[model samples]
Target: MGVSKLDILYRRLLLTKLFIRGWGRPEDLKRLFEFRKMIGNRERCQNLVSSDYPVHIDKIEEQSDCKILDGHFVSPMAHYVPDIMPIESVIARFQFIVPKEWNSK
Candidate 1:
């Protein structure tokens, strides 16, 4: 399914809140989880939180000037915002499943 404009707006709003509040509130953390789930990145979000929650929060704080545009992350330092890849394309690029038969070879 294609990302809706509402989703993009939601993400932008959520990130804005995070940038302002610094993720200290439980409500904000819950919202962050919801945002990650919406973007199909819950696992990565969890990993970042578990590995170094403070650092993760710091990174968001550092990107205070960044913006989310139609699901693409845009940084002030970047001259161009790259196109957002479809979910299928992203999954195909990162997912590697070895055939079961390969184990017996």
Candidate 2:
């Protein structure tokens, strides 16, 4: 193979960093940690609630004269600079994507 998996992972991480910055700053790191506890294993990745945002974004794109920028952070701190969104919204929608073993006996 010409490409290394490590290289690919790095490239993907680079893209992720760009996207995260594109959203601006993390509103509440404390809230984020609470989310981490719910999700388990702390991973500081970009949070985008597909269920809400994708649909909301599509409708906005179709409707308004204003240019829709993906989605906005609903958190009070993030209201001004809502780029990264927040994990709170996703957990609110999908519940937790807990492992099968964790759920079943």
Candidate 3:
């Protein structure tokens, strides 16, 4: 029943309020778009922009000064990889590539 509600909502401030910036502020979010951002493609975003979620690539640009929480908008290779993986991990993996020379270093 956990996934029964396919949507969760939280805002940008929640991260700060929880970690470094403390204030007992266990936040209440009307919606939380926790899904991973695909790597920089405009087409996919065009499709998802109409989706019911709040945190899609298209939506971020609408904000006055939207601060990207962790990574950049990754819409390029959305369908190429597994969808079930955590968004952060997917992005981090994509952001970093182990150099072949590092093994020798």
Candidate 4:
């Protein structure tokens, strides 16, 4: 089977000359981190910082110049909300009180 997209995205870029050299290119690094964050993959962000770069994960403070990508950026409210029925129909059926003053038309 082919490697999954998630697998590729989370692949370790550390010790790679290309990645180390491109560390200064925030334009490139930003998107990778952003996508990872969007998908709530904290590991990817941590890997980028601790593995992709020359510095160790523990040396975050020492490498003040490097922008630290934290996985906590992922929203805690990130969860699936399934829609079982049309929102408008649900609102019309379940609305307890309809204001007389409000235009029903």
Query: Which candidate achieves the best TM-score against the true structure?
Result: 1
Worst 10 residues of 3 by lDDT: 25-34
Q: What is the lDDT of residue 1 in candidate 1?
A: 50
Model 2 spans with C-alpha error above 4 angstroms: 1-20, 28-30, 41-105
lDDT of each: 0.41, 0.41, 0.37, 0.39
- Candidate 2 per-residue lDDT, tens place, 1-105, comes to 255798668546545656457733334434554454544533422342334543222222332333333433344324323433656653222212223244456
lDDT of 1 by residue, 57-77 (tens): 112112244432222222211
Misplaced by over 4 Å in model 1 are 18-105
Model 1 worst lDDT window (10 residues): 53-62
Which scores greater on TM-score, model 1 or model 2? 1
Residues 1-105, candidate 3: write the lDDT tens digits.
242233233334544546335533232221123323432345655775445523333222223433333233443334343443356654432222323343453
Tell me each candidate's TM-score: 0.22, 0.19, 0.16, 0.19
Residue 85 lDDT (model 2): 60
Candidate 1 RMSD to the real structure:
18.9
Q: Which clashing pairs does model 4 show?
A: none
lDDT measured at residue 58 in model 1 versus the true structure, 0 to 100? 16
Can you write out model 4's per-residue Cα lDDT over 26-93, one digit (the tens) per residue? 44454545554544666544543333323223212223333332221212112121232234433221
Cα lDDT, model 3, residue 93: 23
